[model samples]
Target: MADINIQRKKSSPSPWLLILLVLLGLAAVGYYVFRADSDQPVTTAPAVPSPEPAPDSTTGAETAPRPTNDPAVADMATEEPGGSPDELAAFAASDASAPNYGRRGLEMLMASLRPLADRDDLRDATVSEKRDDLTSATSRLQEQGTSLRPGYVAAANLIKAMQQKAYPALEADAGELVNRANALSGRTNTAQEQQQVRDFLSRAAEIVRALNQPAQ
Candidate 1:
């Protein structure tokens, strides 16, 4: 046992190890924050790409549509038509709304037929009144077309037949157009619409004649 005193060994963490652990923790926290910000938001809706706007092509135009109650057609009249772009759009709409020639013809005549149907002199067996009526209808249809409304084509057809042969044939044509006009008139149309319907009806006799007219 000599006077040899061994100093007790003390265990302590190395400074370098402590510093390295602190740096690793700081790096992990920074990585976590960045990852959170970069992730896309969770959404229930399917993602879709936004649409791009159409380019303006209209730069010149001379005419436009007339103002009317049909909200669908209102813009057709006033759109500052710069060129054919607007015109094309309007034309497409018109063609779609217009009545088909033979398919959707009216089932039968309404208020518009009053003038023709009630006339005792013309409504009877005499073919003369029918011819006269057909002529008048033809003129009116021409007027409508020249005025820029092409809706009177059926009426015009009736008128052409009067110029051809008479009697049984004219009567047959008259029936077709008159029935068509009457059917239109019977509908719940507005005053203006009713007027158009009436105009259509009055021209029935003439449309018959037009239909019979020789192919030209």
Candidate 2:
């Protein structure tokens, strides 16, 4: 009986098995890194805030937007000199003893006649239409009554002559009107009143000059 001691040889792993194990380990590590990245929160840029409006220098408040190019807005921004014709006429028609009564009355006269004298359609207007316009303007003037300065009477008379077609005396009437207006010059108490009277006279002179032209 021979005692045969058979020793089992220790087998090493195959190269393919070693490669598979290495690949599995690498795959696990890659999956954990991918999951860690996926779990992380996303970063983004911060939002920018709007700029504040500039404060007004005088009021220390935010200024309003600038006005557009609308004509009505322009008209509102810059008021008419003195006031509108309707406003002047209203002032003239008020109590006779008001402080600005005489000045406003004369201003109303100037304002009323300015459109008539400058009317482009005047030449084309019928005789009756011309008389009607003159009559209306004269009536507006007369509404001021004693509030109007003394000189307006002659001017009104001249306009009346035009309405009546009394052309011969118009020249004399116009001359008298000019003389009266000149006589009243610089007689007003205030510089403003004086300017108003002067403006009225200038406008009256323009009307007279237009009337003096040969009938077209």
Candidate 3:
């Protein structure tokens, strides 16, 4: 009998070893993907825009925001001018103790005299009409029960001089109006009062200019 040589089959790779290799490969791939994600920059939400400031009602302009605690701003707010011409006139003619009495009285007097001062004819019917207004203003001031300030009295006296056709006196003493106004302004506690006095002086200066104009 011929002796048959049996060839031994080579053993296949273990299933558990193959499974372990696949798991290791999957873990490495997952770790690389996670690392790629971690390397990117984080995103943030966009910022919201601020709202605009409101406009000023009187001037029709936009006003900038001011600090509430700022002393200058506080003073400006506190000293803001109040009332209309009619109201100021009433206050001026009411009483000596009235708020802004002297200032308002002077303002009213200056306002009444402005039109008459600008006229070319002192004896025109328009002069009488304007003088009537001045008379009415002075009458109210005189009717007030309280004693008047020297500044207000001086203004009234000047108006009286105009009523009496004392042109020379008016010309010579017109500067006294501004001088008294300046003195009163210096005594003012607020910018608003000082400003009112300044306005009175400006109007008084215009009257002086009209008085000084060359005769036609």
Estimate every model's Cα lDDT from 0 to 1: 0.40, 0.51, 0.51
lDDT of 3 by residue, 2-78 (tens): 99999999999999999999999999999999999999999998989887655555556646754597643543343
Poorest 10 consecutive residues by lDDT, candidate 3: 75-84
- What tens digits encode model 2's per-residue C-alpha lDDT throughout 1-216? 899999999999799998999999999999999999999999999999988766656556656757688744543343225443445544544554445555555544544444443345333334435434433433444343333444354444434345234345356655555555545532355666555555554545444455545544
Q: Which prediction has more favorable TM-score, 2 or 3?
A: 2
Model 1 bad stretches (over 4 Å):
14-117, 127-129, 132-216
* Alpha carbon deviation, residue 198, candidate 2 (Å): 13
lDDT tens per residue, model 1, 1-216: 679889999989999999999999999999999999889687698889898755444544535544588733532332223223222223323322244311112212111222332344334433345534433433333222232122233333333233233344456555555455544533323555544544453354234323324433
Cα TM-score per model:
0.21, 0.38, 0.27
1 or 3, greater by lDDT: 3
Superposed on all Cα atoms, model 1 deviates from the true structure by an RMSD in Å of 19.3
lDDT of prediction 1: 0.40
Of 1 and 3, the candidate ranking higher by TM-score: 3
Clashes of 2: 0
**Minimal lDDT window, size 10, model 2:** 138-147
